[model samples]
Target chain A: MSAQPNPTLSVALEHVEELARGLGESGDALALRERARDLVTPLVLPDRARHLWRYTNPERFVPVADPTVLAPVAIAHEWPREDDLAAAALIAGGALRMVEIDDTARRAGVVIEDLHRAATDGLLGSLVPPEHGFAEAINTAAWHGGVLVRVPAGVELEHPIRVRCVASAEPVSVPRVLVVAGAGSAFELVEGHVGGGVPALVLGVTEIAVGPDARVRYSLVQRWDAGVTGHLTARARLERGAHFQMSLASFGGSLYKADVGAVLAGEGAQAEMFGVSMGGEKQHMDHHTEHLHEARKTHSNLDFKVALTGAARSAYTGMIRIAHDAGGSEAYQVNRNLLLSEDARAESIPELEILTDDVRCSHGATVAPLDEEQVFYLKSRGLPHFQAMRLIVYGFLGQTLQRLPATTRERIEALVASRLHEE
Target chain B: MTDSTNAVFSCADVHIWVGEKEVVKGVDLTVMPGEIHAIMGPNGSGKSTLANGLMGHPLYTVEGRLTLAGEDVSALSADEKARKGMFLAFQYPVAIPGVTVASFLRAAVSARRGAEVPIRDFRKELLARMADLDMDTAFAGRYLNDGFSGGEKKRVEILQMLMLQPRFALLDETDSGLDIDALKVVSKGINAASTPEVGMVLVTHYQRLLNYVRPHVVHVFMDGRIVRSGGPELALELEERGYDWLEPAAAAGGA
Candidate 1:
């Protein structure tokens, strides 16, 4: 690992060490925290010419020195069907606060508690891989006061678990979430992220471990403000015969990068991933998705769509990897970009690594402006110029929008519509 | 030439060009209020081109003057002309995958009325119009024209016409792919939208639609020019004899 080029980023690494020392713990938690702190200085910055860093600057996400505000962020955004949720949690200042669990889920052996306290149980960092990159290590070292949700085997929760995370600038707010779905259990999760339009950084990490034969549906919507530079990594690891459905939506941010992937580790496991993002003004968003087939007879599909307007830019990369032993696996990936204006730019890249000859894997990508026939059709119906453009953009992202979690569906939809009207 | 001051829709020496080639060559027509004119022709006769060109489709270049209710509208854009009370039922209405039928109609109605319509009033009006067309009412919630059958597409076109209530409408092959029941339902929608103030131009390759909705005047369009114009009897004669003789008549009349 090379020395940090920026003095401020180097100070950021010292701060992580300082934070780890402040914990003053012994045993596994201290080892994990110190390991992350040690990794910060030795980890090398990704090269500019690398595939993941080709479109976006890697230095923008390096956490800078800022006053760590420990107060909880004010809840300003709207959520959906609040009363019907099985669990509702507010995450900010690296601490999970104001969490409530329904009596039904509580009696059914669903556990929702503080992550730091749960760490001693040897569950923290269980699903997080040891070979993670810089952002994942930084999150592990800096984040605290997060949530750990555990659902016991054979228990099914009818209502979705809702989590609203707010990260204030100047604090380098890092929110961590970990979920464990037991075997033969079923559950749904809806997460919302907000607060980031300042000079500071917001890095978040989420990991889901789907047990054998478990069913899980997870969705997240991001509504950060412009000028907020954020980095988030979300991944799910599936066990034998498990089924997982995931979605991620990003509507606002100055520069936000998301890495969402699913690992099909169990035979006959299936996963579906859908992503939606909209960029306007000077917003820059980069999204990367991966579906790794590590077991035989696994199936996976991914669809990601981005609509860019104004001078906004988006870069999307989708990857599908099949291991040597994963014969008879099927994987498909599709990325579509809708450029609403001439000034707005989009880059679509597809990456695939198939080690086995018996697997079926394919990927497709397209970058196009608004459909002329579609716009003409709308205009002929007496819709004005801007309305026609808005309708077309809305329709371009329709597939992912329709796949959002039911609890966050209404709120996310209204936010998208309001953003379209502003343009 | 005497000016028909009360004519709702009129075009003078209209020529439509698709790319470098001329499709509709110097065709002239006038339609008055309370009138339904069938522009009948066989395949590739430019009937659809004429219909699309008159409504300001971008792919076709039109050279002529089009007037609606005594106001010239040839220089305006498609949406502007639509706001000026002109509508064209497309031969192949494009599919908009995400926008619901109800929402799309709301936008169209809002554009025509120059303001946003109230939701309650819009919903009531939409339900009533759907009932008038014998539609399932669930169609309002579906994405606009996406995955819709051919008959359903035509029905939605008529539904748009009913909602917009334009003074002049150009229907381009609205009956080509309809079954018997669907054809009747669409015919009913067309009839319901045709009021005394509306002038309709129905372009068809056959007289199938005319059997249900009687036309006051019929024009036999051959090779983009109207070779014969008469009362409703012309449509019956063409339906019986077919369009095979039109080339001879077109040649004989030097059209």
Candidate 2:
């Protein structure tokens, strides 16, 4: 046993161990339980360290207080027992409001269910990979409860349904999600986080399974409070002819690290990931993404842009892998950063690993600051320094906004303008 | 005081140094309102430097008095001088990304006027001025000069000059890269901005622009000072004879 781990971490780990045992006696559940037992040992605690915990140390984020005294609480919702949108409802926000999934989805032969019931029915263990060390360990150890979402075959939904998770009065919140979309189904999912005044942490893990011929648009908005730290990991498997579109916006948080991955398990699978991150003050935001092409005729493109101001810092590392049999695959990745101040820092690394010569793959990275001549030109037109900076910053991040829906784009622009005012 | 008494801009014994290279040395220039004055010189003759100095660029060290509308503006920032009714249509305008030309002009107008102009009136004025320049309506929505064609960028600059309505304007090589049609349009725009209350200093390396702009006074700038001041015929003469013949004459006269 590891010298009786820190009180805050020990209790959290103990809670996860107990919960993993109750997640049903399946292959994933048994594997997670065995892993949970090892988490308290010296080998897992000190010997096997994680680069993911480089900042916002997990021990500090998750306090190890007694779990027996913990309260069983569910977020207050406006509607109860509603499954309007397709896809199994996975993790609901701590301060979430349940809404009707809309009449259009109900008429499209889509079946929507809650994650709590899915877990009770043993569907959760089958979706989550027991190999995700930190995220899996975090969820198996400490997730209070979550949602499950499933989209029926051949259903198409026009409007995107958002599941906003706002944090309040919690030092640590672990959220679990499981999403399954059937073949030929199309839907949009937005997972959002909004934070308040509390000093908090979020360990978020999401597992998505995209069936053959399905199209999924997933957007993650991390607008945490300045007092919070977040560690999020999301993974998806795309079968034959499926498409996955992901957009990530990290606009807040003192420290955040997000690990996102996509596995192209079938032929003709395609994935496109886009992200924009803005950091201020002493904030640090890091993103790591991987595209694994295990089959032939797969395609993937990744674009990540980060703007750093004040003394903030950001680091992005992205990789694309083409397996030996994954010939004729096209993969491209780019990471660009705009430095706003002398003290602001940015690091970008775009890498590709290919075992097949028939594949077309390229990766590039760039880091630059606001052009002084451009600022001078604007100032010469009588705009102040701050106004000029705002203009350039907005343009630098406008590419990501162009990837969003019209209404969502407007809302994001308003949010960015409001944040600039705060500065 | 009716015709030549406005004294739009006056520079006395202006000596400018750009990082130890004395570009404009002991020059004197004055432009009275309602008259178009052209400064014709070859490359590296400090014509653009004089224009930039009048706009109060920090890069140039000024050793003389620069007065705009009879007010001393030698010590102001470039933007401050611009707000004080002095404009420079740059030789190569820098593209300011993320800023629309319309919004940039509105901000500049508000800064110059020292108050917020009503949106309705501002919009009306912007449309009127844009139409006057024969500019495409789509130009207003574009990021300021970003990825603009050479001719299109110059038109945008002229549009800004007309909207600001400054007391004195400095046209720095505005006709450098323009074709005949663009040159005609640009000259028309300059003429439109030249009222009895506004004066202009047109700087160009080629005297071909002088044919259309029709300057009342033409000055030859060599080693910064006005080496020779004459009627518009001097520009025509320089176009025929070139600067080699006058360099020796000016040198002899200076000695």
Candidate 3:
């Protein structure tokens, strides 16, 4: 099949060809490699597209060839000692030592480790489901290292599992993270990505699978350095009676495109996705998410709120898809954004596709500045102009942060508050 | 009835402006302890502006004196005014999302009481009050004033006034947007909160509310000033004959 050809898509295909050549002449890896190569020429890219690169200009995230030479991947530095439950380090292009929890998590049958070991042992394919997009194929072909977590059946974790993935150099960090929750299990997983170096590119990917009757609370806090340019793709699958809660906060990045999505694959499953992003100083952050109902009797809700400051820009696009056989399903999507500066810009679009007549689905979005009444209320309480604005904005985002548990709220707010600027 | 000698709230020839346009001009008004006085006026008569100004709204500027219980509260903030036993049941209450009713009420009560309210005692007291207003116990779990009907918001406002036990209150159009049943419930709430220790100022555009909650006196305002002062019969006279009934007196009052 022919796909639209644009410069960005061409650049992506060129990078895929280089990666395929580096993979050498292997058989099993060849299948995944060939799949990626085929996507390079077939996936269409345009200034205005629906699915991939909707929020961000695909040209900015396209990989450019280097004339010098291939550089070696460096290991990331070890994280400082803290009171965190569990921690892992990914420096450069490889995995560091995995942090073992004190005891509670271990007893709860939580397995957090490096994905290289899991992939080498043929466990990655069984854990995380497959993806069919161009970015997914490119990630499957060139990913280096990542974090993997597995929760056993009937196990409940009181503490959140924290995963820190870092990229020290300019390399496609196909950071694949496979999180599989056994049936009847419940847990929280916090994933963060931090990195800094020269003007380089980092492509990140993650696949999550939540088992039947399981509940998985997942959060992704992406605060890449201001100089980094890249795209990130993450997808999740939920089985029957499973519930998934996803939260994302993007604070800093040069040119970033993030695609986050989930699929309800069984009856009685539910998913709620929440996102908050702030862009400043010419930064552009494109965040797209979708919830697909593939079975009957499923429910899903999505809320995304963003703030654009300075000359920065952001785009939020989300979709809720209900299959024809997925009768008796319910879905809702809302995206609200605030434009803080005249130069700042934000666009939000929430779409719904219902193939069945027995389902209820609705989508809406609003992009505007802060409400005058809310601002006046805060000011009447003695806060200055900027302080009042900050309070109102914080209170706006605090809606999403308040949805988390107490401890999780504490952690997420600490990061969000720091990233917020008074003006 | 209590003595009218007590100074519940005293405004000395107050001049107020909203965006360079004078709303309350050289006006004097007072309400003594245990007295419920209703201020009836036509639209643009600044009745609502006066109520909001007393509550320390930043949207208005005041150039005169305001005192509550012998305390000069002219410079006090809204929350500070609340601590001084002054409350306002806004005509249009703001919806504070992400804050549950129980949490906001508890916090407000704590702030007013300056002490932590015991959970059991709080729940017991809140449930009793909810029953008084015919509110479902589940209402406490929803977000504060979020998605509440007009009548429900007014009930919540009165609920706060009742629980806070304020010394002076400004009920701004609290009865403007309620059905007969809701009006009865709201009036009952106001009547319950009206003890000899509290004084209330009811600012409304309609005299229909006066039927449920009788006031000792009613004042007619026009052109940013109170043009005439009379008994409760003045309200009925104005409602029946409309503001045209005051045209002759308004002209004779020297404008």
Candidate 4:
């Protein structure tokens, strides 16, 4: 519980005060700002000694005291349109630039709007409590114009909703999102983060609520420039008989840290999480995930794969916790890492805590270099060295990537291939 | 087979070392076009080492000369040699979990031809070859060697040989784990690919494989060197009498 003093935290705290003063008399907004202030006071910045932050250095991120410092930048809106099932929202420089929902979805009572306005409507702040961590606290306090998405009860969207966030050349940017799936609603979401190589810092938070019997599939792809430092945090809750599926891919960023957690709070709830991360050329990427089964008959499964090369480093930690009352629950977790070069390094840790004898929990982890036999076999068939390596790396990651929605999976695969082939 | 005039594949005074230990001692071998030379030996007699060493596996330190079509390729890499019209059917084909068999063969075929093959033509050719080998068409969509049975893995290897049409090929224990039916199917594929311009060297530990695919010459490999060399009858004779009789002679020759 020792407080770790961080310049970035102090700067963020000061910025929160300025933002709170600007709110004036908006009751819910003012109340949320006050709660954020309270949460920031005793907040202890995590250090390398903390298990979750052991592989990530928080000092690398420089905080922005003034939200106005980031000038809005235009983002290209090129997207595939064959399915006509996609809705998109674009945010740039901490501001919502554009939001688009298909006519069918809009007519079905799906709400996609600015979080600042959503706050006044009493639809923000509850899903992501301010007391989560330093990153969450700062995001809750400093996010300028985040996006909020809500699908009404009994509505099922045919296609996915895409959210794209572009950070400007500014030294720091905070992006926030909140998603709510009403009871019996079904939808999918794809969130992407990208920016120019301007040595910036991005702090992002996403909160999701899956109502009873709702089905939601969410994916996040982080492809920031090599000069960016990204810290992304996410929390999700599942109601009775709800199904929540999530996938994450990290292919860029000089230093990236992601913390994601899911809570199965009702009977018969299920969660499946899959992730793939590739790091190269002095990059450091860390991912941490948690599954909390708080009710009986809850099920959770997590599989994460990572590949590192060229002096890059990565760390993955997954934990499954089954409460004493969560009898008949089943949880499985696996983390696999492949090191493509001698200088590359990776560490995987999978842990489990089951408080009930009737519950089933298992975890496994593996870290190793590329299999020489497989490479030789590919080469023996006339493939050049680089092609052989590429095929093997794709094969290694395809296990998790194949589980993603087809279009999203292909898009991420192309991004990963381009990043891997970068000189 | 020692007639260097028309020999498509030749190895002279080659020694292979894995780390500091020599796995293949000084050896000389030559295979003329249209001839199948079978190298028979007891278990752990360095048959695989010789095959891999000739194929220029990176793990082994090789000395002396390996030639194909009168060009010295002693320093060429595996892929480089493969592109130069040489192929090796691995004893244990490694599984590539996500790359489909069709994609891998297409790449290999393109590399061999130095150009891309049209999809329709490639599919037609692939399906025809697969049918000839009694392989199911569904395997083309499956991951290369991933979750494949032993017989299926061997069949895929021969299929690659047929598709690439290498001038010289080496089969390393390709018949080891296959049953009678699978062995015949694999052997048929190998025989069909053996043209007058292609030379082959099949390495095996038993004579069961030689029954399906006939070999013009048989060489008994003991330890790391060839202890005996003769016609096809040599394989049958060794099958009747185990390799124990040749151990003393091979040791004496080495000393």
Candidate 5:
């Protein structure tokens, strides 16, 4: 295990094969997993100074392998009411337990199926970048089961599709999901990640595809337990005239690192990404955002914010890359960090690689203690110390929170406010 | 006379320092109930410094004593002084993005009262205050002071003063940047808050705001000292004669 490279850490092919054997899958998935493991073995591990794993060690996310068939644990989850959802998926112990679709969506030719069957039919690993990263490669080789949602062309779904994933398997749980938005269709997805307590790891990945003229909104809210180590990747590809809006909010996990990105694959594609992260206690969080412009006349905007209290720390990296032939593209990125305690720390790095002419690209990053003047202003209004700081933090996160579904926004706001008091 | 214990608010030999500079060199002031004391000064005369220091801004180190309604408040924080009936309308209010004016005022009002204000009463009063200042009620829903015009920011400060209803109000250049129409409305809001139980101190460089909200006494403040104190006509005198007449006296440390 110690001889393994840093990229895949100690997770070798034996671990991958062990998990695959437990899944009891045959043929096609076998070929993909084998191919993924081979791709990982010979590849050079990414250096922290080079990219990605600067603040976190990848080995911490690689848990001990149970090497047995995944059986469900007695963990509990409260999913949104069926009436409020176009469809819902439940994944437990690295296997899809249920996929429920509304009659309206069924009539509109929307398809929601188990990821195992989709991969059996060779649908897995199609949209996620093949050379995504080392952790993603391990996920590709060892991921057991999840869900896939396909919205047919020209169909507009009124309700959001919700996916709930729980890490019931001991030590390590790898969950994956795929989403397809057909041409001229409108799709909204909300993913809720929970479970996995002390001494557990949940390596999750989600891939999204937006067809031409499709409009999609994807929101992933992560609430892993305090002792869990999480490595997550979620990325999307946009076609011609497609619009994608994503909200990523992180609140829990002992140590977590996430890679969220989008590739503009067609002309006139637009992606608007927003992030809200608050860390407390001894938690450590690292986030990386990527926007790749592969087509002309594309546009992308990103705003990611972090606030930390206690001895918590966070690192944020934002990258905007415009391909050589991709002209007339516009990209903007902004990152803000607020430190509530003297011991809390934050680091922000913004990188932009513009290769073409006639493109507009700008990036900004700011790190500061909560504005003293603002806190004093709120305090002078008669609020006590904690209430004043709470109000400031609330307002700081309010912009991105306003972009979320009202109910979810309220829930997260309450959770964040309560956590502020706790700290 | 201020030692009589009947004064609404008073500060004795108060000196304020912003780092190495002593902006407000030892000064004494007293405000009787319902009486407005106008501290008129030039741009750098430290009038704002005095107001902010009296309100206990942490950046300014204050020496001497401050009493609000006969309760010593020199050791209290800004919020503590607020709950004890003190408020300062800033010369330049800071922008707090994403905090709506309505919600900010609600929290402040609740803090002042030491309890949450009822929603019905809060909304009703907020709208009423906004209307009194010639501000659209929609303004309450906007982020506080974010991208607000100069006049709008001044008006919101006065609106907040009205909402908090502090016993000792410090209007620090609250009249600056306000046009005649806005000046009139803001002055009206100030006058409405000046009751027998309240004392007011108006800090400004110009007398235009005095036309609508008359001050009972005017102090010619220069070089951090009060060079002259007199009746309301003192403001007119300073406006007509300018401040150079008393420059020597102020620079010499006192009237």
Candidate 6:
């Protein structure tokens, strides 16, 4: 793509450059800044013509003026104790505020620190290539608050680590996370987003690397307020005998787009992706996911469910691609959507591209309203209409939630129940 | 028939319509507190439609008066009617995936009593009911009617009837798809639920179920109206002959 001289995009790009300049040049940070400068010119804004941007408009999330000029607002730490999360880190006002790691995890060689410091140590920007998409490019260039988590070899943490990013009236917040699970390591990570109901733009990305024989469970919960527009992207690479599972629960944001992809890059690698999204009251949520099988004896499974009410809308597209040399690979994808209101709508698309005939691959997608028979069944059992609908929706989304850890599942169930009541 | 004042469930000139087409013509029936009334009909004779309409299905427009224990309930929704001690066992029980049978039963029982039952008491009651129905305790954790066999669904429906203790129950084609063993098990559950305080209306196509749970009153339904009324011998006579023998009389009556 050639560079375009659009005034609005130019202003945003210049602001990103100015933010990069302020971070100071040091080791990997300097190299990343230079790369970001070169990439901004060719990174054109996405439009509806592209399938990835078909359901959303990128220009709406791009700030017209210099975002760096806005002053930071103080934000309080309000993590819920009921979640029982092991460790947590906070990012607010475009900076890393605090990080808390459990003593056991710290003693077991688990490292959780600022991404800039990791970048200075030449430990950033290697997993996620900068040229993948506009969001990634912008995040690489102007990321304000970022974190890196590394679990050394043979270390198994019993509790889940949570990283929360809250936007406190910032015009633009670019948050990033990089996770590396060393060989034979096992752990779980939970990433969350919360907004202050300001008309801000958030561009975020998370990169994961699961080493040989490592197992990782990662979840991303997006709960931005209705005033924010968010674009979140994630990518993961799994080595030999590595098992990785990732889930996303999206309940907030006026305009949200998420692209999460995983690649089984070595033999015996396994990956599973599951998600549940509830959209209501004129909200727009677009989700696209991919599973890439690049080695023999690799397996992947994906299941996503969405429930829409009021005038909300959602679009989901899933792709499974198997390389030519990847034989004995098994892949499955299923997407189901429930429309709870006449005005609510959803679209599901499941695609598969298999280059070899020696693989088992299947995909299915469905968009349907709440079954009247099921609703009447509940009503006949003395449940009111709203309660009947709620039960059915919870049942529909529970298929995905049941796959998470017990604590995570309970927390998400509570979040989803509250969201349903609010609508 | 007993006095109308003592009737637990009563209906008068009830007509059910789906859109503009009336499915159940004008019909009148009444059942005392300890009575079982069986309504036998041919296919497409509006047996199930009548049962659903009487339960206040939103799709059908029900006209005329319906009463439960001498109170007018003609305008109540299905849930409201259910809370007021009315229940309908569906012909085709819907499979609600991810909702455990135990949880659904608990919610229904709670709604009926207007208070949440303590977990210990609820579990005890559920286990006792399941044992009575010969159902495995593990079935309680499974999704409500999801992937359950035909007999299992009917048994669960009866289990709900026993748990909720509705004053009146309507069973619609509950015996349609079942083997002899399953039918007997389901019939045992139904018989166990038939107490003196709870009246019942069984809508069926066959008299086989009546042999297990004999009814005090039998009504022959045709073309959405009751063509004839008699006692238990009527079911045996219809079984000996056939519903074809009554079509002529029904047609003349309609004219």
* Chain A superposition TM-score per model: 0.92, 0.85, 0.87, 0.93, 0.92, 0.94
- Candidate 5 residue-wise lDDT, A1-423, digit = tens: 123354444555565555565566666676777777777665445665655777777667655563233555655555556347888889876678788888999999888887766632354776664467766777787777678889999999888888888865466777889898899999788888888755778888898888999999898888887888888899899999999998888988899999998999999999999889999989999999999999999999998889899999999989999999889999999999999999999999998899998799999998899888887787777888888888888888898788776646776888788789787
TM-score of each: 0.86, 0.85, 0.75, 0.95, 0.93, 0.96
Each candidate's lDDT (Cα)? 0.83, 0.75, 0.74, 0.85, 0.84, 0.85
Clashing pairs in 4: none
> Which structure is stronger by TM-score: 2 or 6?
6
DockQ winner: 6
Q: Name the TM-score of candidate 4.
A: 0.95
Compute the lDDT of residue B5 as modeled in candidate 1.
Answer: 84
What would the per-residue lDDT of candidate 6 be over residues B176-234, giving only the tens digit for each residue?
89888878888888888789988899999999999899899999999999999999999
For each candidate, report its DockQ versus the true two-chain complex. Answer: 0.62, 0.50, 0.16, 0.80, 0.74, 0.80
Q: Between prediction 3 and prediction 5, which has the larger DockQ?
A: 5
The sequence of per-residue lDDT tens digits that candidate 1 reaches over residues A1-423 is 333455445525444444444434345666676677677665566766767878988778776552222344554444444358788888865567668899999999888877766643555666564347677777777675578888889999999988778766445778888888999999998877877645657778888999999999998788887777888888899999999999888887788899888999999999998888888998999998888899999999888888888999999888899999999999998899999888999999998999999988888999998887788788888887788988887777876778776666667678778889878
Q: Over 4 Å off in model 2, which ranges?
A: A1-12, A17-100, A106-114, A119-130, B1-5, B12-22, B56-65, B97-142, B245-255
- Output the TM-score of candidate 2: 0.85
**Worst 10-residue lDDT window, candidate 6 chain B:** B1-10
**Poorest 10 consecutive residues of model 3 chain B by lDDT?**
B1-10
Native contact fraction (fnat) of model 5: 0.67
Candidate ordering by lDDT (highest first): 6, 4, 5, 1, 2, 3
Candidate 2 clashes: the total is 20
Which of 2 and 3 is ahead in TM-score? Answer: 2
Instruction: Please give the lDDT score for candidate 6.
Output: 0.85
Off by over 4 Å in 5: A1-9, A15-26, A42-44, A66-83, A119-121, B251-255
lDDT string for model 6 (A1-423, tens) is 433546555535555445655654355575575576467664467646657777777777665544444355677767665554456788888887888887888888788888766642353666566777766776777777888889899998888988888866777888888888899999899888987556878888889989999999999889988878888888889999999999888988888999998889999999998899999999999999989999999999998999999999999988899999999999999999999999999988777889999999888888999898888888888989988898899889987899987767877899889988986
Query: What local lDDT does model 3 show for residue A150?
Result: 81
